[model samples]
Target chain A: MAEDLVLDTAIRDWVLVPLSVVMVLIGVLRYFVSKLLRSSQTPDAKVVREGQLILRARNLRAAGGFIPVKSFRARRFYYTNEENGLLHVPKGQAQNPQAQMFSDPNMAMDMMKKNLSMIIPQSLTFAWVNFFFSGFVAAKLPFPLTPRFRSMLQNGIDLSTVDVSYVSGRSWYFLNLFGLRGLFSLILGEENAMDDTQRMMQMGGGFGVDPTKNLGAEKDGIDIIQHEWTLPKMEQRAEMVLRKLVK
Target chain B: MVGATEEARLNQLESQVDNGGGGAWEYLCLVRKLKARRSEKVLRHGIFILNSHIARSKLGGEEWTLYEQVAVAAMDCHRNDIANDCIEALSKKFPGSIRVGRLKGMLLEAKGAWPDAEKIYAQLLVDNPLDQIILKRKVAIAKAQGNLAAAVEYLNNYLETFMADHDAWRELAELYISIQMYKQAAFCYEELILSQPTVPLYHLAYADVLYTMGGLENLQAAKKYYASTINLTGGKNTRALYGICLSSVAINQLTKGRNKDEKDSADLQPLAAEALLKDYKERAPEKLPLVTAMLRNIKLVS
Candidate 1:
């Protein structure tokens, strides 16, 4: 059998520890940078009113059991009536041509800014790590890995003799990138942007500023929800329980 | 070291405040700012800035929510004048807002005007009978007035509409216990346990109720529930520890001529219970006398 390669302590001090620490510091830096770059836009009064109306409709559907059947029916009619339902598009907007999301210059500008913020720091960090700390085995996993993971673990290294357990500098950096979430949440609060998991999810098209689409989707949801009034049987349930109490 | 870390957190928050990013002037942010400030004077200054922001229309869609939160915080810190000012501003801005009306009721309740609070809630309910907030306030008023039966009725009505409200269920169970209705309380805990079987509190509560309404069947069930509670909490609950001892003895006495399997199960419990009590007594020496007295009473009963 071939001899197992021993890793030097110097690698731990110079490569592994520094890579982990720098990755965490970069995350903390990115958190503040993103926070500083982002602008808070207050939605207009009409948009706020629309959002509130949707929420009220949803609350009525969920907890309408508390109200009498007459009140429930009145609310259901108020929100769903064809002539003047709250979800209906106003006549002016229906007549006038509405702007497509991609056609809006402001939306394009916002998307460009978001993409720049996300891409710039990430590419810069990747370049910095590759230029300075490439081609070295920095650390080893405690557990053995199959040959399928050899290429992933040994990103900058190209030694067939090297064990699959050994991690190259870039792989170490990537590990720290994903693994520092808990530590960041411990130092910063839960909502801090140092959580890379949320950033990854957002990057995968979860975050956007398309209010028109959101409103349309919400209207569709409201239109389809079956409004079975919960109040009609509630009094009976209460009486049954009260009778049991007397027993 | 602690001071340095705290300073770093404060600096980050202050930078966010300067940039006007996130909810810097909102209630939750204000809460963090209030907790970080060393002196009440600093908190008062922060509140002043928050009020200025509200005055300048800097806050957005949820401005009423922010005002309500600030009012609540003001009430907490005994700044009743500020709370009233915020409430007055809100009531002026949204004259017929049910949320604002509810806050007015809460403020009245805070000022020891229970009748006035009740009246406001009743009025709100007449207008919007489905409002859960007003209904809850009515229940709270009933509870604060020490009318257990009235509180129970309100809670039962509340539960009919909002059956999934765990807090209301727990409150109802506690009210039943206060009125010495152990069977009804047991029913409430059973519902809670059915919904959330893994919560240690529900198991412990069920075990306690079963222990109180003692019979051979109840004691055996109580022993099993106490065991579950102990397992869930990793053997830390002293009440569950005592419950195991008492129920085991009760089971043993009640099943004097029962099957060997039942006797064997009951026999194992007291030994484990004694070991748990010993560990608990060593861990909390001040509670040792009470633990010993409880075990002695169980032994005497058996």
Candidate 2:
């Protein structure tokens, strides 16, 4: 009876102890890794926002920013709102008035080219990793069910994870995220930081959802809730309507 | 925000860590949660591309450095295979990147050795069954091996997992037709037609299946669809099987003794002959060599 008790304890220990150790190790490692990877230079949320806008402007310039509109239909006015840094048009508009600031097709083409270069690979890598990692997690899960059941459960996650989660979970998201980021950086060119957190909020369907619900939509949270915080003016909306028709 | 599944998984993993006695199940579940988190991260990045500066950048430039990093990381971690799987998953978002890989895969698939490739693909499928490229590869390999049985099996499995994929159903139906599994083919076509009622090609395929199966009760439906198929194809251009439709219609008319009366009647106009010709062309394209072969068989019988 004593031996049996000892054996049961040993078996239970064998399963639990190593798992606990791995979990702690993983948690600590992830915490440190994120801290290390995140930018310390642009620490504040406001600073990050400013930096992002500036980078976007630079990208717009490099890509040749243009809003295809006739002068009579659309007028551009520059704004000096330091929060937004530099605006190409007056701030109080029904729509994004700055869109008209881009009248040069070459600039538009360049901007579009720049945007595509930035977006295509980044989006692809993100999607690829998303599916892959999700699949991996599902594939590697511990279940008391059949292999078919396990597979069905895993498929409920995504595709990319199947191979990725099998080998290592740490490197799973890391590699995919890095690859996507790098591809975007190379394609978009120079200094423009893509804010993944914001993108995620949008993707999660939380972007357009009523702001009062999500913490991110709070006044002090972030200015990404552009429609709610700073409503678009009338003239801008008219131009936007015309642009939609042409499209 | 994490979903209930991920939260539950995280809690389970956390409990394992806290209790310090959790087993392999805990580790595996934790790994799954972590992977899920990572996927959410990737999706987040994709959203960023859509709404931010990434969407406004040029093609094949430094702006896409993040994607390069992802590729490098995928390679570094030996997830090149996973990266390859990403080709189809990300196609809707990153057509440029995924299409390049897809075309490469297509080029490679053209060479024989698909059976060997099938083993590799099976491993990938075990990991991510929803992977379209890998699934497509497996289907092709199965077909090439003349293992129509296996192809049908995998196709059914794939369809079950991806219920909305009309392409898989279409392929399964086509494979059944090729193997002369008329009843199953007809059933598949019938199901596909129900799902996508407007696509005329589905209707034509269903009729072909019914006709091949010799389901006399199904003939009215078959004829209706066949006529619809002709209308959909503009009555002039037949798919690959124009001759078969023409011959069948002609045989039907002759069997009914209408052809004899029509030929004998002086009232029969040029328009009537044109209609007959149109039916022939619709049944089997004149360009196909099979039409001549079919004619030879008929002549011998006569």
Candidate 3:
């Protein structure tokens, strides 16, 4: 078996530390860039009203156990009633009239802007790292890895002799990209847009699930939920608990 | 006595805070100022903004909310003059707004004029029978007055209308506990746990309830729930760690002359509990005596 390779301290000082620092700096920069690119337009009045109504309905469902059966039933009737139900949008007021993806021009524009902001910075950072710090095997992971991670962890270097544990500079950048989420949150409060994982998910179209479709799905979910009054048996349950307590 | 121009400048700063552009130091200053009961600076700033917004003909319906917040802050600082001024501005802008009316009631409550506040809430409820905000304020007034039964009644009524309000349920549960209504409190916690099973607080609370109720069956259930709580929190909860030890000891005593399966399960818990308690004690040295006392109690019981 080949002996374990010892990396020089110069690689850590020059390549590994610089690559990691640049990756974190890029994340911070991307957060500010995205913040600048973010649309200042707030949701319109009708959209806000609809969202509040849906939230109200959801709240009623989750917490209905606290109220009386009569009140629960009344609220349930108000929400699920055929006419003037909170969930039932008036004709043409539905967010997606055609129920098609990319149907709304404004929504399409929003998706495009979000995708560009997320993709542009990430691709730029990757290209910069590949061009500047590609060749050297910079660091080794503390843990063992299978051969499956060989291509992923050792991106620029094509050495057959090198073990899978030793990661190239480019791979270190990617590792820092995923690992620096907590640091970003610590520096720029929890809700900052610097999270690489979240941006990646958005890039993969996971977050682009149309809000209109979500509303439709929510409506379906609300439609199926049987509004059984939780309070009717509350007295009995309370008594049972009391009896247990007294024992 | 602040002039309109000064107010306008202050209002610009207020807008910056509202827009999430204000620095952390600005928020820290506000908190410090409020804590010191020197909210005259903030109150003056709010009035300046309101005045500017009014002068520029930009006082939209949303501006009333800003006015209400300023009024509440002013009331907190005992600056009734600024509070009344903001309230007057809000009432003038949105005369028919129930939210504004509620704010006026809240201001009365803040000033210790409980009867007047109650009257205003009562009048508002008469006008709109199902005003959830007014109902909630009434409950708050009852709580503030130390009328636990009245608070419970108002909370129960409020829950009838807005059944899904977790805050209300928690408040009602706490009130029940205060009144020695452990069963009712347990029921409330049961509802909370059902609604949010993954929440460690709910699980811990449920386990606590079961522990307090303490029959053999209740003790066993408490141990299982305590186990779940410890599992959910990744064994970090100190109370849950103690709970496991206590419940295991209780279970062991209860099943002394019982079957092997019961004894085995009961036996497994205390060992794990001791190990966890030891780990916790090492991590938090100050809690060692408390953990040691609990260990003594467990030994005495078993």
lDDT of 1 by residue, B8-118 (tens): 666676666556654455424544544553324323544655557554376564566656666776766767787898899899999998888888888888887998998
Candidate 1 ranges with C-alpha deviation above 4 Å: A1-247, B1-63, B76-79, B257-261, B285-302
**Which residue pairs show collisions in model 1?**
none
Candidate 1 C-alpha error for residue B219, in Å: 1.7
Docking class of 1: incorrect
- As for model 3, its CA RMSD to the true structure in angstroms is 16.4
Name the regions of candidate 3 deviating beyond 4 angstroms.
A1-247, B1-62, B76-81, B257-261, B286-290, B300-302
Score chain A of each prediction against the true chain A by TM-score and list the results: 0.72, 0.23, 0.71
RMSD of 2: 30.7
Error of 1 at B93 (Å): 2.3
Model 1 over residues A1-247: C-alpha lDDT tens digits? 2477788998888888887888777777777776776765434444455555555555555554433344456656666666877666654564221254456666566666666666787789889889988898888789988888988889999888888998999988887777888888877677674556666677666344455455456566656755454322322332333233223
TM-score of candidate 3 to 2 decimals: 0.48
Q: The CA-based lDDT of model 2 is what?
A: 0.43
DockQ of candidates 1 onward, in order?
A: 0.02, 0.01, 0.02
